[model samples]
Target chain A: MENFAALIYVISSVLFILALRGLSHPETARQGLNFGIAGMALAIFTTLLLPNVGGYFWIVIAIALGGGIGTVIANKIEMTALPQLMAAFHSLVGLSAVFVAAAAFHNPESFGIGTQDDIHLVSLIEMSIGLAIGAITFTGSLIAWGKLQGTISGKPVTFGGQHALNAALGVLLILLIIILCAGESAVIFWMIALLALSLGVLMIIPIGGADMPVIVSMLNSYSGWAAAGIGFTLHNNLLIITGALVGASGAILS
Target chain B: MSAVLIMAGGAAVSPLVFQLAIFVMAIFVGYYVVWSVTPALHTPLMAVTNAISSVIIVGAVIALGAADASGFSKFLAFLGVTLASVNIFGGFIITRRMLHMFKKKD
Candidate 1:
């Protein structure tokens, strides 16, 4: 059974790679998207058929609600705003990873707790990456939206010594990360999160309107990598591989 | 991680397959929705679309938060935020430019 699942997963991954390739050219982008969707649906169906899926009611509800809302938004949105919509979608992906991590953390026992303070490394990795990336993506997306909506100026938001400020923040985030790696440090996580948020703001602030597409592509890749990182943290071979593929292809497309 | 185990057990589908399916469906759904609703929106509807797209980023980030990952995973989360902001705002600018194209001299 696992082997079959793996095989399906592998094929799906290949499709994703191809879809991305197709997406690079506007002419084939639609077809690529179709292929990608088909692949994802297959994966989801397989997931639903898993043995321990006792909570069918909630799962169904979530699928229905999410799908309905998504459909409405997609149909109603305009082409002129396509770029913004794409950005928002990327942000959502990051947020999803974050939520997944949180859920996993709360259910450590279900994640397979070992004796003698057996910390689930995979779970920890998932939680850490999810939280950090999720937070950053949330703030960044908001800023992007604001800029698009003209609630905020599209001009790069920079001040004297801004680069230095970014450097300092980067160093701080790295330091916090080191602490978090050694053990669970909620404080470090909080600080690093703040730093990342500020960094996100600063990074976009300096970029001009012409660079939005590049920024969008970069972010998509980041979100993909974030998912893959979660997959790694959880020791989910499928997630890591798929996430990496998404990230790499997105980079190539950009 | 328990998360991995849970994922491993669930429906046993491949990520590639699932994501690809989602992507294709999104395009179709997006096209259909736009076709149906374009006439209903005012010319400035582009503004709303831009806003909606930004909101989607918020949704995606929220979703990622729901995931089970850490360290590098968290770092990657920032990528989405950065991208969404630029994308939505960039569109907003383009819309303004397009509008300018139609403006007659005072």
Candidate 2:
């Protein structure tokens, strides 16, 4: 069963890659979307069949509610508002990364990482980095969405020592990660998450609204990296591949 | 130090190393593939990528499926599922809409 699931994942990964390749020309872009949808469906189906997965009642409810909301918003939103919508969607991905990371942290054995007291060193590092990146992406994308929506000022918000403050925070974030890795402390983990959330807001507010497209794309990249980091924790290859693909795509587009 | 470096290099390769190799290569693939996309299709590209990135939902599904998931873990996973579902549906629909607009002119 595991082998079969792995085989399906490999095929789905290929389909995803092809889906991206199809985007090279408008003639095949829709075809690419179809490939992407099929790949996603296959990946999800196979994951559901994994030995580790159990109940599905709540899962169904969650997907139904989310899908309904997404469809309505997509249909009603003005094309002019697509950038902000993109920001909104990126924020969702970011938040999902954080949630999944937290879930895994809370139940390491369920994730096939070791138990709470003996989680693999690599897994610990992966979880911490994933949580941090996810937090940053979540808040950064939110601020970007607000700016694009005109709810926040379009003008650059600058302050004296802004770079210094950001620099200090960055260093502190790294220090916290190191501490978390060395000691495997949950407090340090949450601390990194909170600091990253703040850093995301601080990092984006300084840029003017005109630069929001770039910021949106950059956040898109961060979302992908966040996903990839969590993938490392789960030892999931498809996540790593798809995340890298999105990360690279966002970087290039930005 | 040199001996330690050499020994490390010669040690049996871990699965993480293999996954890292795949990750790095996929980045190159994405770089080339995305660059070939025409300027006119950038918005659709962003939308489509948004759909694909929701692949993270697989992680949520696994979390939800876990037999021993606590209420807190389940809640987190449930939120992950809901949020990712929004991206998957909204992203694809909007991308298709944008692409259709382009096709009308062509």
Which run of 10 residues does model 2 chain A get worst, by summed lDDT? Answer: A180-189
Show pairs that collide, candidate 2. A54-B65
Candidate with the greatest TM-score versus the true structure: 2
In candidate 2, stretches whose alpha carbon ends up further than 4 angstroms from where it belongs are B1-11
Q: Score the docking of each candidate (DockQ).
A: 0.05, 0.74
What C-alpha RMSD does candidate 2 show over the true interface residues after superposing them? 0.8
Fill in the DockQ of model 2: 0.74
- Predicted candidate 2 versus true structure: per-residue lDDT over A1-254, tens digit per residue: 87898889888888888888787688898899899989999998999889888788988898899999999999999999999999999999988998998888877878899887678889988888888888899999899999999999988999999999999999999899888778877788778889999998999998889999999999998888888998899999889989999999989889
TM-score of chain B of each: 0.43, 0.87
CAPRI class assigned to model 2: medium
| Tens-digit per-residue lDDT, B68-88, candidate 1 | 434443334334334434433
Span of ten consecutive residues with least summed lDDT in model 1 chain A? A108-117
